[model samples]
Target: MTSTFTVLPVPLDHLFSPGDDINSIVIEALSTTRWPDESTGISDGDIIVVTSKVVAKAEGRVVEAASRESVIDQQAERIVAVKHTPRGVTKIVQTSHGLVLAAAGVDASNTEQGTVVLLPVDSDASARQLRDHVIDRTGVAVGVIITDTMGRPWRLGVTDVAIGSSGVHVLDDYTGRHDDFGNTLEMTVVAIADEIASAVDLATGKL
Candidate 1:
């Protein structure tokens, strides 16, 4: 199957207030933006990812009257481990999904003072909803992926990760496949989604 991506450009820059809800803001952004049903000539199995900021906005996950520390406070229940570096990122424990970066998976860039944006309430659900909407709208059997910016170990800057996906498999295992030399491929599940996410970030200049 072929793979592709569609990145929406909204240029959102703001802070989420505590009173803000993450779900509503995301829906609102989607309503305002003209995300067409067309795929710009992409074939099936293409994954379309909207930046986490837009999703967070639509969900109304804005916080106010507090900084990064406060953002972490709300996520106290989800924190699994903490790391120390020039910048901070905690290895978080997730309930509905796997162990991710943080409670809200939030960061301190392109946000206003005393506020930060949290992740979508349910990334997979959000992706499914969007995918269904698109199918209903355009009859396209395309996949959808919701991406968020995240920091990586030994990496200098931030990049996108697949928080949501539909009709696409992030991992491809070839453990049983033998190499040209007849050596079995061992533990060969590639993070294709993440690789595409990084490529999209570069193309869209999401820095």
Candidate 2:
């Protein structure tokens, strides 16, 4: 027997806008990727990881580009740190999502001119909604994960991390399990959602 892991990037042919139905858009995009054998389409237990940008756009979280700074300030709970570079000022702050990240996850890339994308108000809820909608449309019990890019404290570059998840176990607990050395694992756990997001990020490249 053999086990394999795969991540397929869904190619979206159209640009998403505010008020767009993400559930339908996602289903449509996936439909184009189906194999001749319907059984090989989205299956039970498969996870669909989507970038937070589309989710934000669908949720009408866009603001004028000139308001980027002000919007970031408002999204932040508290400023953790700040840096002034040639481009401009960069801020690391704690957001309403309890995520301490740069500019509070308010992004200004890959969007329309003079506009910026804000993080979804509730990522977990967003994931749950997406998961339910996908299941309803395709009858496939798939998990959904919404991801955002963040710079780690000790890392030089940014990487995608899970901000929302549904129908998937986010943690893999290894407590009470013995290792090869027979040492009992008392406090071992893995963040499954974040790991999946990171893997998908590597496969899909930057958002």
Candidate 3:
């Protein structure tokens, strides 16, 4: 038998605001959005991947600063590298959450003008809360992943990566496993969370 999975984008029409309940909003949206089989609800083992921007917005992480640089400085724990491009100087730094991202994940898109959005205070905690809420409301065990888009160190384009996750195995360890040819794998740990996030991003696009 062939194993298969699906990626469904939940259409949320309501704008996220400060102090909004994102879990409830997501549940309501799922209730309204029809599945491929015409089902109206989530199922067990379903993985819900969410964008970090919405989570940050709902958590009141938006701020108006003198400049994006200032916000980046405040959020960055340590500077990793810097690059000067035609656009401007791009600083890749490790944030307080230990995420090494360009501009410290200080996003200035899809928000009010002159305001930027920061990453959630604790993304893993946020994912756990959402996962718990889903189980509580729908009685379905689901995995939740909060994602953000970032450019790879040597890659040209950006891709979504998991910054937070819950109710899911974040990594698949094949270190001690043997291959079909009987070659023992020494160091093989796949980041399944980030893979899921990247797949979801392909469907959701850059939001």
The model with the greatest TM-score is 3
Please report how far candidate 1 places residue 145 from its true position, in Å.
1.0
Where is model 3 more than 4 Å wrong at Cα? Answer: none
What is candidate 1's TM-score against the reference? 0.71
Residue lDDT tens for model 1, 1-207:
574435555433445444454434443444444446743333455456666666666667666635656665555556666666676545554434553565447655656666677777787787787777766655658677788876666778777888777777877788899888999988888887777677767756745
In order, candidate lDDTs are 0.64, 0.89, 0.90
In the range 1-207, model 2's lDDT, one tens digit per residue, is 246777777887668798999998888887766544544468888899999999999899999999989999999999999999999999999998899988988888889988999999999999999999999888999999999998888768887889999998999999999989999999989888989999999878864
* Clash count list over all predictions: 22, 0, 0
40-116 in candidate 3: lDDT tens per residue?
67888999899999999999999985578888998889999999999998999999898999999998898898888
TM-score per model over all chains: 0.71, 0.92, 0.95
Q: Judged by lDDT against the true structure, how good is candidate 3?
A: 0.90
Best-to-worst order by TM-score is: 3, 2, 1
RMSD of 3: 1.5
Error of 2 at 157 (Å): 1.8
Which regions of candidate 2 deviate over 4 angstroms?
34-39
Choose the strongest candidate by lDDT.
3
